[model samples]
Target: KTEKTYELQLLNSEIIIDGKLNDLGWVDVEELSDFMSINYGLKQIPSKKTKVKIACDNKNIYVGVKLFDDSKKITFKSGSYDDFIDTFDLNSDYFIIEIDSDHDHQTSYAFAVNSSNVKSDYLVYDDDLIDDNWNAEWISEVFVDSSGWSIEYEIPIDIFRYSKGGSLTWGLNLIRYIKRHNEYMAWVVLPEEKVGIVSQYGHLKNVNFQQKKTFNIKPYFAYDNEEYEDQYYPYLLDENNGDISGLDFSGGQDTYSLSQSNNKIGFDINYHPNSFSVLDLTYKPDFGQINQDASEVNNTAYETYYEEKRSFFIENSLFFTNSSHNNILFL
Candidate 1:
């Protein structure tokens, strides 16, 4: 590593922009595609043009994406991928972001929203055979800035762990509306047949600064409404298909799934221990809808991008991180 001093902390939501907000200086679909096409020599097909703006403070990264001409009248599809989706279920536009903290390309993070307003967070582990079972709270806000319509997201550094003020590269990919048009564009483009998460992304350089550490512990005290069912049914062996079983979710009193958003009753703690060495403790576990797999050590390419904050350890009420790493004598 070279010897240098760079401002590493995004301490507050205060972003230092070099100049004024120039919507004209924006990257459109074609311009972005052409840049990617020429550089990667990939015959990039075109997609719908969605205007986006980005800025960051010490505490949060401010992203303003303009989803133009969204046909609010149409009833878009609300579920997973299917053939011949009904006319009422085609959303005109949505958004996705592939974030790679450093240049290591083993796997990266993928988050998106569909035109029907459905939200999902998936892992681009093997970009080609992309599976969709990752759960992350795609929590964000949008308001009319003086410039244009903007989406403001407060993404926590603890959500994706890295040292304070540390810097790394990222990848960007955005899918569009108008499914008949079938458009998807990238910041750094790739091939036409390059379909899933792995093949599409281009690089975004230098973005991270752990200005502060905030573990938002909001344990809601509320009453359960749904009919709680605790039934351990027989597992099906047939290969036909399955549904989002209400049985799996229902509980004894009002069962909770160790989820932050849906289950808001328990004293769910978000621990922010002083030492970053507690890194071994923090884990972002798989969701309840589907507990896929959780044995991988290296998440993304960047040595600075892996932060596992799984809720299982918290809800179970036993913390192995401090107990194991510190060799604490707990009687």
Candidate 2:
């Protein structure tokens, strides 16, 4: 089958991202439908219907999606912000937007949002190699009605690094998941035997590109203060009265107060050195706010694996690793 293509148009007016597709700018835009199911390498009609539309402006690209289903049967869980309901549960409906900013078809960005309005984003390298720790800031609103549910996204143009040109064509793909039927549908049906998912994406044509200076800096500050008290023996202390030379503290003990404090300030700089590449710099890197990994107890003779969450190291890890499949060095 030939690859599908869609011509993106400019929005006539502003669109408020209220999760409703009632904007006048989207009136003349065409909708992409007739999604096909790719379950077990079989192409068939899904139980529900799905449609997507794309439009753009000078500063942002707008996406509107409608997922038709029974309002009551929609599965979702409510939790804290960025809880990512889709990844944690097996029975949840969600939408995924994959965009190849550079149109290289080798790497892409995957943005996902569930019915609960929670969002999660990640980077895809070599089609299927996913770096789930990657995060981006974007706006999305979700609305649920009796007929079905819909979502709207406003992605900033500055988030991606694309080639310089008057007009550009990017790769785009949309995916929808239905939990009730355990069905998966895609606008561009990816065959199971396909070598790469991103390579099979449809084209998003006529993207007006204007090269502007892209530079961003994020500053983070962290403070930690710890206070505690400990008991020690006077006889065990040396000349410093605080040093113990591997002595057993089983004799009379005296209490002493101890306290420690630390402060860290760091900045993450992102600058587009050219139209096709981005330069990232970190000064005194600080990633204390990132989530901690779950504690695991190992019984067998196997090495423990830990995911890299540092922004500086994982920003452009593909280039650092020379596109290695193992991804053991930089990911």
Candidate 3:
């Protein structure tokens, strides 16, 4: 089967990162308006109109989408931090952009942003397993008008590892989820048998990118105070002595103490030698933001596995993943 393809034009002028697509540079870029429903067949047109435009610069790829919905009601949940996968439906309207930078089909990156500008990103492997803990440094904004809503995205080239400095072909797909109508539309129609749509993504051609090795250093200091009462017994007198036979047992009084404080200083360094290799070094790692694993009842003989949500450990974890074993191993 032939796949849909689009040629990304290089931006001549600076386009504002705002959600409004009023810039002059976007006028020349071709708009891809032929979208199909992901739920229904490709022949049926969706109720709402959707158009997507793509452009690129030396440092980032810019994507602009205009979604025209006639419905007055729109669904959206407002939050900043990551939410549980089960709670995604409670959020408002959103869109997803799945990209396979390496065109390997074995792995792809999925970036999504809701109407509230909340981000949901993941790393998909083998069109099956999804690592929701994967996070990338990207910017996206949303604007709502009387007609419909629009979204603009700026994805840094540093977030991806691909062959640079020439005409490159990458797998690309866009999905728009209309929460009010419970509609799912995509640029490339996905079959029901397919689990992850990244494996069947269409092609994005003529993408020429200039790669630069970048380094980042993040330093942080934290001070914490803990307050708790500690009880102690300094001494214990012998109660089995014959001299105290007429009396009862004897014991020393308890002593109590107050709180304590601790302070720490650390730094994390991220260095990219090339597109394929990344080195992450940390002096003192902090996992305060990571949520505790949810409680689950275990009735099976095997152990239940929980996903890793820490940002430092999840980034670039695909490189260390073993597909045969379906596990991420540290070497």
Candidate 4:
């Protein structure tokens, strides 16, 4: 028989949310029953009246959660590692978090973010664990949510142990209580399934550090025009063909290209904490172009590829040119 290993830990800073994150004010992790609310779209069902909380000390990490379900229905599913490209399907609600820069091949940004704010994690499943290699000792305090529902969990710090040892910026995300009608949105943005691997969901920007560091700041801008031959301009993509064709045949006219141009500005600040460490990008614009792939590249590297043709990183991307929307994902 053969053996396998894993890593998922590193050094990093705290996450503080002072203002209202979304329109709703911050909900305390203690009295969760008062927070859960009923949402209409899905099934006119209310949120679970549960509490989700996690506390961590230097030596260990702890997570505490409370779950409230009136239906008393709970089910979980896990998948094997070798099931993508060769075997890919979005048959479940999965959210992932991967951390690199601390350990080695045993662990990586395979399922989440590193200590840096680079969005290069591809995960599967929300709320549930990804593999059997790791185990989470979870306990739930349930309740009936005529108003709504909720749950709580406790995760130990030993849950992760990576290769490279240094301060890191870990990514966080959650996905749960999703069905045909009702879907719980991701803490991180989840793009459409048809977009497949081409999306940006669950982005944890600017996770700080407390180790050797190199901070650099840069700001710039540019402008361009568009031309369309087809009066009915459409996005570029081939749901029919599995090949990637450029902007030529997607339904635009190079002749009708917008001869007009505009001007704008942007900035970037990155820190290289250690050799092989990544750059931080929490403050970077959601539409800023990225730095290009170096003439030399590393095998276990992570990066973000946006749809907008940024002046910075416009090449080496697997983007969907047809869909007319800003659909990004976590992976």
Collision pairs in model 2: none
lDDT per residue for candidate 3 within 10-62, as digits (tens), equals: 98888897788888989999999888765554446787889999999988899
RMSD of 3: 4.3
Per-residue CA lDDT of candidate 2, range 1-331, in tens? 8878888889998899999999998898889986888788898998899888899998888999999999999988665444454342454788988999889888888788888877877777787677665667799999999989999999888777688887899998898888778888888888777788788898889988677777888788999999999987665557676777665567668899989999999988988866677878888886684668668898989989876667766666565544564545322
Off by over 4 Å in 1: 1-47, 69-92, 126-131, 141-152, 163-165, 192-200, 211-310, 313-331
Against the unseen true structure, what C-alpha lDDT does each candidate score? 0.42, 0.81, 0.78, 0.33
List model 4 lDDT by residue over 222-247, tens digit each.
67665445344434567788455545
Which structure among the candidates has the greatest TM-score? Answer: 2
Q: Which of candidates 3 and 4 is the stronger one according to TM-score?
A: 3
True-structure Cα RMSD, model 2: 5.0
Q: By TM-score, how accurate is candidate 3?
A: 0.81
> Per-residue error at 31 for model 1, in Å?
12
- 167-234, model 1: which lDDT tens digit per residue? 66555554444454444444554454455555445555457554454455534343334444453543
Candidate 4, after superposition: displacement of residue 180 in Å?
A: 7.8
Compare candidates 1 and 4 on lDDT and give the better one.
1
Alpha-carbon error at 170 in model 4, in Å? 0.8
Best by lDDT: 2
- How do the candidates rank by TM-score, highest first? 2, 3, 1, 4
Q: How many residue pairs clash in each candidate?
A: 22, 0, 3, 69
Model 2 vs. true fold: TM? 0.83
lDDT-better candidate, 1 vs 3: 3
